[model samples]
Target: MSSTPESKPSALNPDNKKAPVTNSMPEHISLDKWADTGYEWAGEVEPSSFQRLATVLSTDHEQTKTQLDANLYRRNNVLHLAFTLTGNVWLTCQRCLQPVAIDLSDDYDIALLENESQVRLVNEEQDYLLLDEIITEQSPERLLPFKKLVEDEILLKTPMAPKHDDCEMTVEQFGEIPEEEESENPFAALASLKGKL
Candidate 1:
């Protein structure tokens, strides 16, 4: 979606000058000012760049990357974050226990809430993004780490039990099933003993 750029003054500067924002994604960002100014950030990041995400991946294969775009704006005095993430990740297949390539692409729009009390104010009409104290007040300048948000979205999109459409491996691959040999039933022996008695 495209909108005509509004001529609002930069929140960082009171002189109505454009804020000098970098093209490269920042590790942390201020949501309040960013949303008020209608700022947008886009970049591509490797899965291995995120420590939490890296641990879940089957392998750190090269050439796999996630393209992300985030747009911040205010709606009805509420901060909103719109995100788009697209990439391919290698995950362990639950069925075969081998690496399975999974394509991830999703778009999400969520309102940023200041506290749990604010969550109750948000109607069921929209989704809300609640910030923990650690990410909000505790962070320097009340900025949140962008990597953590990106990693969270990727994790949410990942399947709980990943499996290929057509698995090459079968149950036999796990282990061999022993042949069943016929044996006399215990009930038959009891019957024989009863007859002798």
Candidate 2:
């Protein structure tokens, strides 16, 4: 496998200018205004920190496309993000190195912590966080890292190389070796001795 670095944790920082961007996604849309309004975010999930967890499944002829389905619930200053993801992706087969299509469907359950004093801290110890109330400052974008997770799962499922189950080696593939020359038993003299007995 190629050693090109997968996106790093620092690359996820929305403020990181060093992150390489091949595709352009509009700067994150804020969740603050949509919080109490009972609106859901539905659009093309891009190559952001959260979206990186979810691999967009597609073919060479298609682009990365995704749909975000979620219910936003707020109570006692907590925001609950609940959603599902559906998409397809093309991955190299481990065995034959051929392109294979992998489909994905995922459910997301996340909560954001909130406090009034405008205090925001990322506790690596926790899986979720407090949501932001405004778009002015850099807030962690509420994207689910579906792609990366999917890629990992696929890696565990795929074989080292892909081949048809019924495939057999052709004569040309066997090359010039004769069947007698390929025999494993070198003790032909023992067989002759048994015949003399």
Candidate 3:
């Protein structure tokens, strides 16, 4: 969650950036109902639950286990979320062009707005998210699915260009070398010839 820093009394949960994200609360619910009691839930969702996540990952291999925790609460009628996602992942290092093991760990705080008009109420608060839903007479329902919410949030966190601290070009990617591979590199002879010249 990216938001402007503020110390106002009505500041949407200061922990939005530190918050964990969720699933299984329900397809949709009356925002007013949950806000009254300050509903909270935390749990892990399976890797397969992130259908969009797979397409962005670089590996043909399946994603390793991932764990996530999330809490939803509100301040002054403004919905806020704190989410944490952690686990192991294989991402291709943009520089090395090889799989790099990344220990996935990230936290997000998001303030969800019911309508753009409400932005003024909490515009100064950090990480505010307002979705513009197209409502028509045939499809007037404006509720977004719980699963979609989680997926959208997580997907936004994916790195555009994942990389390792050091690119290991000196080493061969395939560890096991065949017996014949013991031969010196063909470039070695070229270098030796250059020395003689």
Candidate 4:
């Protein structure tokens, strides 16, 4: 029995069309092509899926969730990505050292650049995604990973130091503080010695 090469999928074939991308799908896609077609994906994703984000979260990874609404389109010879992320995450409170539920909801508009050199040409008013030349030089994969993109957005929104607006617990409550005792001023002693001299 002989097997035909046409039966197998090949990345080299330019004519072969890929399946439509969805929020749940973990795949890399060509940003340029996706923008030309005006592709859109909307769905919910578990917070646990974001490995990097889970490291900083105060609560269990499975307890949180996020909703993603994204659209890719080309306008004015520039590829644009419009996305909205909404979710609730448990972050460690800086003051109380307890879990603080933070509501996360934000919309972003980003311009995708084919090369790092094009980043300088992008409008200062808009956000831009600069493709890494080093990575592309090593691999033929021009498509960007959808899951990694989502993870990046979440990481960007993560607070450096999250804290509650009004913490019921105070520093004094956490530990005991010794009362400070007053001592003679060094300047007064120096002045007395100078006077004697």
- State every prediction's TM-score relative to the real structure: 0.70, 0.42, 0.56, 0.67
For every model in order, what is the number of clashing pairs?
Answer: 0, 23, 8, 0
Tens-place lDDT digits, model 2, residues 1-197: 11111121232233422222224222332343344433343444432233433343223334355454445555445555555666644554545544555554566555555654422343344235344432235445554333433334434443444444544534345456665657556688788798788
* True-structure Cα RMSD, model 4: 9.4
Q: Which candidate ranks first by lDDT, i.e. highest?
A: 1
Candidate 3 shows a clash count of 8
Candidate 3 per-residue lDDT, tens place, 1-197, comes to 22221122324344323212334334343343343334344454555556776666666546776665555666767776666778766666778777766665787677777787777767575777764451112334444344566667666655678778876655456676657547668898898899787
* Tens-digit lDDT track of model 4 for 68-140: 7766666666766677888788888888888877776899887877777676667788888765631253345
- Evaluated with TM-score, which candidate comes out highest? 1
Candidate 2: segments with Cα more than 4 A from true spot: 1-27, 44-64, 75-77, 114-197
Error of 4 at 80 (Å): 1.8
The TM-score-based order of candidates, best leading, equals: 1, 4, 3, 2
Candidates 2 and 4, the one with greater lDDT:
4
Model 1 / residue 119 / CA error / Å? 4.2
